[model samples]
Structure formats: structure tokens, C-alpha cells
Target chain A: MSETEALESMVGGEYKYGFTTDVEYEDFPTGINEDIIREISRRKDEPEWVLEFRLEAFEKWKQMEEPDWPNVEYEKPDFENIQYYSSPKKKDGKKAESLDDVDPQILETYEKLGIPLQEQKQLQGIAVDAVFDSESIFTTFKEKLAEAGVIFCSISEAIQDHPEIVKEYLGSVVPKGDNFYAALNSAVFSDGSFVYVPEDTVCPMELSTYFRINNMQSGQFERTLIICEDNSHVSYLEGCTAPQYQDNQLHAAVVELVALEDAEIKYSTIQNWYSGDEKGQGGIFNFVTKRGHCRGDNSKISWTQVETGSAITWKYPSVIMQGDNSVGEFYSVAVTNQRQQADTGTKMIHVGKNTKSTIISKGISAGESNNSYRGLVKISPRADGAQNYSVCDSMLIGQTCGAHTFPYIESANPTAKVEHEASTSRVGEEQIFYLQQRGMDEDDAISLIVNGFAKEVLQELPMEFAVEADKLLGIKLEGSVG
Target chain B: MLEIKDLHVCVEEDPSEEILKGVNLTINKGEIHAIMGPNGSGKSTLSKVVAGHEAYEVTQGDILYNGESILELEADERAHLGIFLAFQYPVEVPGVTNKNLLRQAYNTIAEEQGREELDPLQFEDHAREQLELVDMKEEFLERSVNAGFSGGEKKRNEIFQMAVLQPKLAFLDETDSGLDIDALKIVANGINELSGEDNATVLVTHYQRILDYVQPDHVHVMIDGKIAKSGDKDLAIKLEEKGYDWLSKDASVL
Candidate 1:
């Protein structure tokens, strides 16, 4: 067959994680109101201060409007038709004491996703906080983390168990009124991971969170917060997936991070939410607001993400370099295929003197899809001698796909320097023939070229994730020949 | 070992304009044949067609390897069947190290031949031997496949790949185009060492400079997409001295 025909065949692979599990669950009525926010806070048994925080955020969300600045085009989400909260029905509302007490169906679902529930069989040296629907099912290796004075648990539990820490850092980096989605997430956010690394101590193992949206018509509003004390280091990973549905689902999440003096935090995400059918009829609208604050001198924060799913994705995991000699980095690889549209990038804000930031983004578009990279680099007057470097590259696979880059740089300091480079290229016939002449088939050649194009960002992921991301790109562009 | 009968080929973009019109040639085992031609004489097209390049349509022809028709095979399929082509300007594939590509290509051919595939360690040892044959440094294996290499380095890499694949029918298409004197000798020497009684070589060039290093059993002067004259190695020297005008005029009269 011809190369073009083979590429067209790539649009037919089904989403492997699209099967819904049969689990009995309770969900709130569709719509948002003050009572609903209060009920959610009461269900979690949050303190009065936390309840007041949600109430104030809900008031702001009621006055806010969804922004349309992103380049992606999608139907406006109907807030009234979405279930803001959903959770698996439990016996007498008791939390699971161990893996055995958790629902068998939920455990099976995690197993099918290649996440073993047994601690021995789980990924070695990695603690996981598995969030299903609106609640954390289980958290592994808590004892090991607690031995080092680290706090890792579901945000709901943290609000009740560690209210002082939660109240001090919550909404500190990403305030409740930061953006339209962030405001919504702050009001009725369900469950997400919360981590705290102690001063001068490196976390013994990697911390991870796996989020799954199983209930139909339920919007997943998860809020994640992480704090690193002075001289501490932590690496966190996040992964998400959802079952297929004929109606669109909304996922608006907020992630806030804080790094103290000499602290370093690395956050990585592999978003594989259900991307809908080939016609783009039903899929998740992933609009997320994630940002980190380098609060002390010599602090560092890096965000690395590989986004391969979601019909329409709009997110910018950004950083604020508030401390002198702080470093911020963003590396991303976004792939869109079969009617998917993604507009994602990062924002670097330099506030203190001698701060530095780097941004590298790679976008791959195939099968009539559109991928865009939009980023901003800003240096305040006080940030003298600040430096920023940005590289954005896009690779178009077929004739119908589109790629765009939008970069904004503003520097008020005379010594501040910002560099931006952008390029767009297509997989050409000559590149395919060159590999073919060396005994590689069409699919293999396309995978090789696509991986090579995204190597700069893929290599930034952890070892296991780097391999998984490579295979994910191959599957997403199975037969596509650029 | 290979035969081409009344081959008529044209660019797929404009098939009516034939680039190789009714060409015929043959090469047996243990033989080296060199095709010399001027510009636009279809020398490169002939080699590409033999290697099953998809851009060129074989309108009326059949290519047989070991008495089996290979006109319908793909380029990679032909490579697995012991057909190799040394490109004039090898394409650069960034981010794929030479060692990684060579291991893949070598194992692909090895698996098809019912031979045990080499593991990474074994392949590294095997590839080092081929690197020495091309006078290449061990560091070259760590570099991306031909990316950012000089003209001579690319040529040497092509020969190095040829030495590894060990094809029975090898076509060197303008392999000496951008080589310096030292590089040219190394490439020629590598080709000579790889050639034996069980394999054959076809050298297509516009100059006779490469022929001085590797002797040819037969030299054919290709004019207007056909072998207008065939003789011993002296034919290349004559063409070098008299130019293709004499051969074209002689063929037109005949």
C-alpha cells in the first residue's frame, strides 16, 4: 500500500482504557449552588476555615466567565449538566483500612490499568495515591514516607488531619481567583494528592498519583498541593484516565506547588484521558491550572508533561521565580490525532534577581487535528540579570493536520535576556524512504521519526515514564507516515 | 546473479516522460560491472529502479534476482533479500544513533536469513569490525545516523553499512561524488574486500576516477538511457578521452 493510505489507517486504533467498570456509586445532582459546596465540605468534615475558603471561591466562580483565549475550538461545557461530585458507595461510609477492604471492582480497574494494588507487586520505590472518582481509594508506602517526616495523603484527609498546614499553603501559589477553571476547582474540588517534604530531607521514594474518572456525566475537579521545606527535594508523577462515554466530560483541576530555600520539586504528568471517537463526538475537555512558586533563594521547580489524549486540552503548568537564583523549567510533548485539539504551554514569571527559566515544547499533529504551543516569559524590574530560553517545535504528520506557536516575552530589567526559537516541519517522503532503504517498514520509520522529533522533551521524563511515553507516541501514531 | 530485460521506467510525477527507456543489462556472480554516463543519462535512475524505489514506476520491465522476478517487492523487502544500494547523498536521520540503526538493520537481515540475531553486546562487537573496514572511529557509532557529518563521512557511513549488511547484489550509485582522495581509496578498498565469488557489484558513476582503485570486469557506456556501447575496462578510458558525444553519434548511426 502507499504511504498515505497507511497513514490514514492509523486513525482507527481504539482507546484501550475506554471500558467502564460496573461499580455502585452515589453522585450529586447536576448543577452548582452554595448548598452544594457546603454539602461537599461537610461530607469531607472540613474545618470551618476550609468551608469558608470554598464558600468564598464559589462566590467568585459564580461571577467568573470561561475564557476563550486558547486556540482550541470546542463546545462550551454545560455546568448545569455535570455532576460536581461522585464517589463509590461504601458500607457505612467507612474508609478502607487496607487494600483488602477496598472495593474489588475498583481494585480490578487499577489492575487493568497496569497498576497492581499489592505493595510487593507495585512499582518499586514509588508511593502511589490512587484517586478513583471523587475520593482516594488507597495510599501506599505511607509509613515509609512518614518516617522521614513527610506528609502524603488525600487532600480531603489533609484538610481534616493537618488543617494548620493545609490552611497555610492552600491557594497560596494558585489563588482561588487565579483563572476561571481554578476558581471552579477551588469551590468544589473533589480529591487529589497532597505532599509535604520535611526540611533538609530528600524523599526516599518517588511520589505518584493516579486519577480515574469512572462515573458518566461527572466532572473531575481535583485540587493537588505540594510543599517542599528548605533544603528538601521531591519528585512527583501524575497520570489520569477515564472510561469512554458518548457525552463530553469536563475535567478542571488545580495543582499548586511551593519550594522553599534550596528546595527542588520536579512534577511530571502523563495525561491519557479518554480522547473520544474518531468523529470527536465525546471526550474529556482537560482544562487545568498548575503553577509552582519558588519562594526561597536557590530553589528550583520543573514541570514535564506528555499529553497524548483528550479531545480538547487547555493547560499551562507555569512557575513564578520569586526568589533570587531560583530556576524554573518546563518540558512538554503534546500529540493530537483524530480530531483532537490541544493548546498548551507554560508561563515563566521572574520576580527576584538572577532568576532563570527554560521552556521546551514539542507538538505533533496528525489526522486533521490541531496542536498549538502558547507560552509567556516575563521579567520584573527587580529581576535584574534574569535569563530565559524557550524552544517550541511542531511536527505535522499528514496533510490535514495543523501546528501553531505563540510566544510572548516581556522584560523590564535592562540586564534580563530572553531567547525564543520556534520551527514547524512535516514528516517528508524522503525521510521515510531513507529508513525504508535500511530495511525498516513504514510504521517503524514513522515511529522513529516522531520519537526523534520529541526526544528533547521525552528524555526529561523519569526512566520508566520515558519508555512508556515513547511507546505511547508509537501507538498514537501507529500507521501514520509523515 | 541479476538480470534486467527491456526495462522502461519513468518518474511517477510524469510517467509519459520516460527516464529509462528500454535499457538492458546483466551481472553474474564474481563479476564487477561499471556503467559510465554523462549528465541526465539515467545512470542513477537505473540503480534506484533496481533497488525498488517507489517514486519511479516500472512501466514495462522485469527485474530478476537469482532467476526470480522482483519487480513487485518493496525496497525494504528487497534489502532483506540481499539487495543493497549505496545512496549518492545519504539522508540524515537525527536522534537515531548509528549503532542503534545498524543493530536494527543487521538483525532484520539476519532474522530473515534464518540466522540467530545478535544481542546488543554481540552487535556492538560485530559493528566494531565493520567500522574498522571503513576506517571509521568507534565514536562514529555513538553519533546520530549521518546527521551533521561531512560529505566524505556520509559516503563512508554508506560503505560501512554495506560492509555490515553483506548484500549479494550491491549498487554503488555515485558513491565517489564528494569523497577526498583518502576517503575514495578507503571506500574502494572496503568494497573490494567485501566482493567475492558469491557476490557481485554494480558501480554507476559519471567519472572513471573510482575505477582506478577497483577494477571492473565490464564497462558499459550508457547514452540516452541505453547501453550504447559495451567493452572491456578500456571503454571507460575511451569515454573519458572522447566524451559521450562520440558514443551517442555512433549509436544513432547504428
Candidate 2:
């Protein structure tokens, strides 16, 4: 169209955060050390014990080098130079009454992204936690959810109001030293969603978080914790998008979930961060660590994600089945267009008897993008008669794109049954011709095919988020198909 | 409305082995033509070439639709010009429902002709009406495109699409290959109903049984990629009675 306007002037065309916001921030100067970790904990007004946890995590992070195992390549981030604590000027203290009370400019960013922020904007039964920049702006349907005795609010507020519950479950699933990015997240995580469903309570609404990175220079480090008590059930959805910029921004996040006896949790994510231009400059370096611990018998946890953005993505939402009769599942559709690269999959570690897990991954590679699925299913001797099934399929759009799958399965229990299936296919020219011959244009044909390929994973999303995810996938494959 | 001149095409993967060797044919409006030949005699190749299939290299052919050279047009462009082909083996696309697909196809062609797209409700009504013409069940529209469909059901769905598309020049590529007697009659009847005063059809079949129901306007015996004999409808009866071996032996004289 017209000459590429400043990221601030853009309205929409797939990348909703193609606009920048005029905002100032109070942030930590680049570099990571014990002092920086303490400063972050102090800035959040956390207890001394929490500060110790951050310092210990910083030490562990220093002992470990940056992971080079992923199929992505990027210059090592100078941790000391990066601002770890960045928040809006003085409005950080102002609590939003509802989505309307949130900054008009911030609301405009979400509107440009087409995310529904009002009560009527929500479909059927999805309750939203809208996180703007480094803080949770407003959470809807909280009063109705209080009737069910479920505590769903911002992590920062949870720490302030429900410190005991937060202290009991925080890091219980994902330890501070889980990974390099996780440790980094523990040291400087700003704010994310906190969810808790009490025993025997079925949450009344689908809990959701819509993360908007408004500031161009801000690095979003959000830490989320979810806990489901015995016989409790909840479904949580997360959607994230960032403003477009010329310099690559970093987003390191950690999400942990704990499901006790007979509890179930379903976590869904539609990640559509601005993936930069075709030449691959100025995108987000998304390194996230998400894990769930099934600590109760017959408990279950499922993670489903549709990733169509980020220039370099290093993520593996995994599950640790530590209780007998627990179940874990991971369904994902990761699409890499242009010069993007993603190395994602899942890990299912069976530590208890009769546990089971399933992983289904579909990767679509277009343009010069590289997509990979790396997974592991480990069954310990104590996990008697454990079972695991993993299916990973990759669809390549063009010859220049690449798709790869790596499965590492280790079983100490002779009775365990673990099977894996993987296939690499190029969406056949015949398939497109068949659709076009039926009168569909080439773009429509490709979108139909890709949607069909990703239907299994898309079905796992909440109804409201699923529609947005489907449209986002369609838009992401625009120029890459032809 | 359809014309093929000195059509010489070869498999793109193997250029030395020619598929269609200088075949020539012209089909006018309102005519139902039957193309019968033995397997590997380029019966399918000729149909694919006319529909602008990309696999076969049309090295020396010129396909014209209404006096315009269509050899350079894309498959979709050819479709916009009222060319439709019922694939011998329908593709199974999971998560894409038949109703959604038909509506998209119908509206795309309509838009290409400078017509407004049918609204969602209108499309459903039109698709439901078209499905009934092929004796298809209403449930077929809700199913994934050919996913888990039976042989007969898939064949009927193809005809259902034909009825909905209403192309001026339709190519039924062995549409009765795996159809049972009942399905064969239903498909044939669907085709016959869709063939009208301004449109035509090219029935590509190996068996003469389908001819018993649809009754072609002209029957052409294909031998070695060329139409060996072109005659009236009775020629199909002759071929059915005497078998293609007789034509193969006599056509060698040419």
C-alpha cells in the first residue's frame, strides 16, 4: 500500500501491534547480578524470603550458559544492559475499575489487535484478564467467579492480598532453577495472571489473559502461576501481541501450573507477537518456560498453543506427572513464516505408577522459516505400566522452508508403552489445484488447507480465542503461500 | 465452446514419454460428448489438459475457450470461464466442511463474473437445493470434505458439486468408475439434469453402462491419444456390443 508508515500510525493488517505508544518507563539498567535481582524483588515490595529466592535463581542462571540447542540463532542478550523492571510512569499505582478505565491509548492498542475487552466482547463464557505492558489492567467477571470461591486476579494483587496462597503454590510446579530463561524470569518477572480454583469447584468462566506490549523499548517478562486444588477444574487462555519496532525486543516469560488430586487444568495460548518484516529484523526473541506438575492422583493438565509469530522462538510447554494416575497432554500448531524460526514441543515426565501422556504437534513452515519439534517422554522405574503417545506432523509451504522433528524417549520401566509418529509433507500442489478448480482463489485455497491442517489444535482453544486464532493464522500465511 | 488443436503434451516428470500426442477435438455448446478408450490411451490426460492441470507439459497444444487461447490460463481462470472437472479421486480435506467449500466455490466463481456473493443463508439454501438434485443426504454438507466418505457417497458428492457449479463446459472424469448401479444412475441423472440449452458436458468413461442412463449426443472412440472414430449415439452401442478390441483393431489402419 502506501509507504510503510511509522509503527505508530498503523491500524491493522495481521500485525495489530504495528503501532507504537508514547510512554516513559522506570526500568533497571542493563546487567544481571545478585544486586539487580534484589533490586527487582525490592521494587515489587516482596518479602526477604522472595529476594533470597531471586538471588539463588540468579546464581543458578550464572552457572548455566545460554542454551544453543534450539534451531534459532540470535546474539546473546547482554543481561546487564537490559532494563529488567519497566512500568508505566505514575499510573502504576492507579488500579483500573474495568477495561474502560484502562488508559484510552492502551485500550486502542487492544482494539487495534481486535481483542475483545468488554463484557459483551466476551463469547459464551470466557472471562478475561487484560494485562497491559507490565501489569494486569483489569480482570472481568471476578465477582461472579467469587461465588465459586475461585481466586482469579493479577499476580501482583494476589501477592498483596492472598500472600499465603501465593507462597504455597508459587514455584511449586516450576522451580526457580528450571531453565536459563525461567531463572531470568524469576529474577525480574513483572506481573502476570494468578489463578486458583478451590477444591471440588468447577470454575464458572474460562479464565483468559490478553497481554499487550505497548512500549517499543520495553522487554516483557511476565510470570504466571496457576493452582487447582483437589477435584477442581479450570480452563485458562492466554493471548499476546507486541508493538512493532526496528530493534529486536525480548520477551522472557514463565508460567507454572499445579494440579492436585483429581484436579484438571487446560491452558491454551495464541501467540502472535510482531514477527518483524520479511527480512527478519526487529522481531521478538521469545524464550519462555512453561510447566505443569500433576501432584495429585488422577489429576490432568493440558497445554495447547498456536504460535505464528516471533522471529526466534525457544519454548517447550511441558508437564511433570508426579502423582499416580495423572495425565498430561500437549497439542500445538506452530507456523513460522518469513525469516522466523521456532524450536518448540513438549516434555512429559512420568514419575508415578500408571500415568499417561499425549503430545500432538503440527508445524507449518513457509518462506525461509525453520520449524522444529523437540520432545521427550521419560518413564521412570517407579512409573509402572506408564503410557505415552506422541504424533508430530510438519507441513512445508515452499521449498525454501524447513521442518524437523526430534523425539527423545527414555523408559526405565519395562512395562511402559511409548510410541511416536512423525511425518513431513509439503501441501500438495494438487490439493491447491483441487480447491482452485472449484472456484476458490489461490489465497483462499491455501488458507483452507492450512486451517484444516491445524484444526485439531485449534479446537483446543476457547471459543472466543479460537476465532481470533483462526483469523490470525489466515492472515499470517498471506504472502508466504504464493 | 471448447476446442483442442494438435494437442501434444507429455508428463512433466518424464518428457520423453508423451501422454497426449497431437489429439484434436472440438465440443460445441449444448452437446454431451462421450470419450471412451482403453486405459493409458490418454483419456484422462486429455481431460486434465483442458482443465489446465500443471503436471502435464502442454508442449505443442492450444486449448481455446470461446475463441480465446486458454493454454496460458491458470486452472482457476479456466474454471472462471465455466470449465469444471469431477476428479476421479476426490481429495479428503479434514476440518473443511462440504457446505463451506461449496459456498466458497460458488461465490468465487460468481464474483469473478461480476456478480455479488450469496449471503451465508442464501448459500446454505442454494447448496441444500443442489445436494438434493444428486440424491445426496443433508448430512453430507456437514461432513468434512470427503473425509470418511464411502465410494458411492464421494461420487455422488462430485455430481452434487457439478449441479451446484453449473459450468458451461463440464468434464466428468470416469465419474462412474466406482459407483454402484444406484449411484451410477443418480450421478448420471444429476449430470443430465444440469446439462441445459447453453451448457455442455464431456463424459469420460471406460464402461458403456453409464451411457445407458445419460445417453451421449456423440460417442468418440479414442485409440492411442487420437479420436479414432466419431459417430452418433449408436456408435456407443456398437462399441458396447463388439467391445473396444474391435475398434482398436480397425483404428490401427489409420
Candidate 3:
């Protein structure tokens, strides 16, 4: 066979998580409006104030236009043809009380994804909140978290059980009108994980949320919020996967984090949504808005993500250093392959004196895909003695793929220092041959090279997530060499 | 142990431009042979072709290993079949530690031969023994494969890998090109330690200086694409004294 043919065969491994679950579920009718928002709020049993917040966000969303500045091309999604909300029906109006109470098919799906939902079958020292479609199917280790004064539950559950805390910090960091997607997520978002660590407390376990979009026609709009109180610490992980479908699915998520004085929040995500087939016929269009606010002195917020899926991804998880001596960090590795396009990086806005921020991003493009790292660093005049460092690197696997870097730095204070570095490289054929001659096959060689290129960012991920991200990257670049 | 029959090869991009024209050679167990030639005499091409490099097309040739044709095999397949090529310029693979690369290569060959694979601890112990053969520090195993290594260090690493792999038919392609006297001695010592009567070694070099440490049983002078003269090690000293111009003229007259 020709070299190109061999590469194609290597990368054409079928998506293992493409099977759909046969579950009795309900979904809203196609399209978005105030009535749909009200129906969603009513179904969730949200309080009046929460409904008012959604309505206010909806009004603002109607006036906002979708941003077109991203370095990606696709037929714009017809929002009117999408179902805004979907949920699996509860058994006899009761939530699953135990593993036996859950639907066998739904449990089987998670098991197939290698995520064991049953407490006895789970990995120790970690709590899992499994969000399927528009609702949290189950949350494990809740009682243990509650003992430590940590609130780990679904957003809808938080709103119902701890309305005062929820109302105080819901949109404080990322306001409703933050962006077009943020506003839309604010209006129609269903279920996502919520965590609250109390003052002077360190969460005993790693909190994670596994999100699966199972409904074929529904768009997943999840709202996640994490709050670390003064002198508190928490590490949160998120993993998402979707079944394969011909029609594009929309996933517009809003994740907001708040770190108070002396608090630290580590947020990591491994996003493995369906990236369509080799021809790019169907996949998810992931438009997400994530931000963190260092609201008190000496607080730190770090965002680490390994993105390997989605046909067109447009997201920049940012940090706002609003307190003196605060620190913010962003580490990302984005892999785009087989007609995928990703325009992603991070934003660091320094607002207080002596603030610091660091950004490291790695983008890998293969098989006609385009990957871009677009980042911004802004230091305000009041941010005296602020320092910022940013490095963006791109790796191209094949001749047809393209990689780009766009960095914007703005400093109003002479005392503030900012440094930016960018580099672009291709997977050289000689490198592959060298490894091949060492007895490793072509695919193994590519995986090693690509992983090494992204090691700086991959190492930032949690232990288990690092392994998963490595495998996902390997799968995404399969058959990418020519 | 290895034989090349009427080998005619060319650049894969333009197969008409033959690099190796009807070249024939044979080496048996317990023999060490040196193919010394001038620049662009197809010495490197012959070594690469024997290792199954894909950039060259063997239009009319057959490479036999243990009496079976190996022309159709991939480079890694040839590697698994006990064919080792110590590259002239070793590629630097950053982020892959020398230890990991050696372990993978060792285990791959072992698995192919149906030998039990060594665990990490066992392999580490085994690799350290080979590291001593090249006089490399223990820390060299922790560094990336050849990345940031000096030219001499890279040559030492090539020999280190050869010691660990223990190939039956080893090809040292210009392994002495960029080495100081100290490094050259170390590399030659490692090669000497690895070579035995049970295996054969082929040294492709442009100079005969390396033969002082690891003597060869036979020396062949290559001009254009074929061997022009075959003799004992005295041929290397003669070529070194008279230069390759006389050999080229003699081959042309013949």
C-alpha cells in the first residue's frame, strides 16, 4: 500500500464511545424562546429568582450576535432547529437511590466508557457526578464531602438546597452578558457539577464530573460553578464524551470559578466529544466560556485542559487577577485532526498590584485540520509590578494541516512586565524513520513525538486524566502522517 | 549470515538514478568486514538499504538474512529480525528517555523472538550493564534519546544501543566520523565487546582510522557503486596512504 493509504488506515479507528443508549427520555421541542426557558426552569423546580435570572439572560442573548472572529469555518448552526433541553425520565418520579435503582442501560453506557458509577467499582479517593444530557444521574461521595463542609452536587440541586449561597455567587465571576455563548448558556443551561469548599478546609478527595450528551437532537448547555472560600483548596476534574451522529450537535457550556483570599482552585478538563468522521460530516460544535476570578489577596486559579475532539472548538478559559499578590495559570493542549478546527488559548487580565500570570498552550494539527492558539494578556495601570509569561507552540503532523498563533499583549503600566514566545514545527519524516528503525511502528512513533511535544501541558493534568488525554491524542492523530 | 546479490538501487523519487549498481557482497559468522570508500561512493546507501530504509528503491536486488530474502521487510521488521544499524547521525527524540527507548527496542526484539520480556527493574539492571560498555554515566539513561548530546556522545549512544540489542548482523554506518580520540576508543571498545564468533559486523566508514581498535577480517575499496578491490586489512592502510583516486582509476580501467 501507499504511504498515504497506510496512514489513513491507522487513523481510521472507529470511535469506541459512539454507541447510543436506549433510555426513556424527554426533550424540549426544537428552538429557543422565553417559554422554553420558563418551561426548563419549571421542570427543574427552580426558585422564582433563578427563573428571573434566566429570563434576564435570555433577553440579553436575543440582542447579542454570534461571534464570527474565530479562525474556523463551518455552516453556522441553526439554533432554531435545536432542542434546548433533554433529560432521561426518572423512575416513578423518584431519583435513583442506589446502583440497583439506576437504569441498567445507562449504567452499562458509563461502564463501557470505563467509568464505573457504582461506589464499590469506582476508583478510590475520588467523587463522581455523572451528568447525562440535561440532568445529573447520580452523585457519589456526597455524604463524605458534606462531612468536610464541601458542597458537591448538581447545579440544579444546589439551587434548590442552598439557594442563598448559589444566589450570592452564581454570576458574580462570569456575568450573564459575558459573551454570546455565555449568555445563551445562562438562559437555557441545564445540569452541570457544582462544588463549594468552605473556609480553611481542604477537600479530602478529587471531585469530578463526567458529562455525556446522549440525546441525538438536543444541544447540551451545561452551567458549572466552583467556589473556593478563603483559605480553602480544591481540585476539580471534568470529562465529557458524546455518541457519534451525522448531524452536528451544539455544546455551549459556561464554567465559572471563584477563589477567595488564600484559596486555590485547580480545574482540569479532558474533552473528548465526537469530532465527526474523517470527512467531517457530523460532530459537535463546542463553544464554551470559562473564567475564574481571584477575588481576594493571594488567591490562585489554574485552568488545564486537554481538548482532542469537536469539529470546531472556540473557547478561552481566562483568569482575572483582582486581588493583590494573586496568581493565575493556564495550561492547554489542543489536538485537531481530520477536518477539525480549534481556535483556543487563554486570557490573563491583571488588575491588582503585584499580580502574576502564566500561560502555556500547545496545539497539534493533522489531516487537513487547522489549530490556532490565540491568547491575550492585559495588565491594568493599577497592576503595578505585575508580571505575565506566555508561550504558545504548534505542531503540524501532515503537509495538509495548518497551525497558527495569535498573541495580544496590552500593558498600561511601565512596571508591569510581559513576555510572549511562540513556535511552529512539523512532525519531520526523518524523526519518524529514526524511531521506526529503533523497532517502534509508525503509529507508536507519532504518538511518542506528539506527546513529547505537548508534554509541558499534559504534565499539568491530573494523573488519571493525563493518561486519558495521551490516549485521546493518539487516537485523534491516527493516520495523520503522510 | 548475510548476503547481497547483484543489488541495484536508486532514489525512490527518481528510480532511474541508481545509487547502488549491481553490488554484491557476503559475510559469514565470526567475520568482521569493512567497506571503505570516498564521499558519495554509495557506502551509506548500501548500509541504509540493508536496514530497509524506505527512501531508496531496490529495483533489482535481493538482501538475504539467514537464507531468506528480506528485501520486502520494513525497517522495524528488519530490526526485529536481528539487523541493527548504528546511524551516522542519530536522530534526537526529545522527551523519550534513553532508558525507555532502549527498553522498548529490547523488549520488541525479545517478543518477536518469543523470548521472555524483562520487567522494568530487570531491564534497568540489564541496561546499566550495557551503559558501562560505552562508559556512559547512569544519568545518560535519564536523558532524552540523543537530544542535546554531543556528536561523540551520540556515537557512544549508538554503540550503547548495539550492545544492548545484541544483533546478529550489525551495521556500523560511519560511526567513527565525528569522534575525538577518547570517544573513538570508547566506541570501538563497545563494538569489540559486542562482536563475537556467533555474530557478524559490517563497518561502513570513509576512513581506516577506526580499524586500529577493532580490526576487520576483510577490507573492500568501493568506487562509484561497486567494490573495486578486496583484500585483507592491508588494503585499508594502502587506501589510507595512496588515497581513493588510484582505486577509482583502476576501477575505471577495469
In candidate 2, how many Å is residue A11 off?
A: 14
lDDT for predicted candidate 2 compared with the true structure: 0.84
Q: Candidates ranked by lDDT, best first?
A: 1, 3, 2
lDDT of 2 by residue, B27-54 (tens): 9998999999889889998988888888
Residue B157 displacement in candidate 3 (angstroms): 1.6
**Stretches > 4 Å off in candidate 1:** A1-14
Q: Which clashing pairs does model 1 show?
A: A427-A482
lDDT of 2 at B250: 86
Clash count for candidate 2 is 6
- The deviation in Å at residue B51 for candidate 3 is 1.1
Off by over 4 Å in 2: A1-13, A91-103, A116-125, A141-144, B4-24, B37-42, B55-73, B110-143, B147-156, B177-198, B206-209, B221-228, B234-254
**For residues A1-482, could you state the per-residue lDDT of candidate 3 as single tens digits?**
22122122212245767879989887568898989999999988889999999999999999999889999999988989988888888777556877787888889887767667777677577788988998898899999999999999999999988999899999888799888989999999899989999999999998988889999999899999999999999999887889899999999999999999999999998787888988998999999999999999999999998888788889999999999999999999999988999999999999989999999999988888999999999999899999998889888888898998989998999999999888888888878887877788888788888877887888887665565466556766767786
Tens digits of lDDT, candidate 2, A274-330: 888889888888999999999999999999998887888888899999999999999
CA displacement after TM-score superposition, residue A339 of candidate 1 (Å): 1.1
- Model 3 chain A worst lDDT run, 10 consecutive residues: A2-11
Docking quality (DockQ) for each candidate: 0.68, 0.67, 0.68
- Clashing residue pairs in candidate 2, if any? A30-A80, A30-A81, A30-A82, A31-A79, A31-A80, A31-A81
Instruction: Show model 3 residue runs off by greater than 4 Å.
Output: A1-13
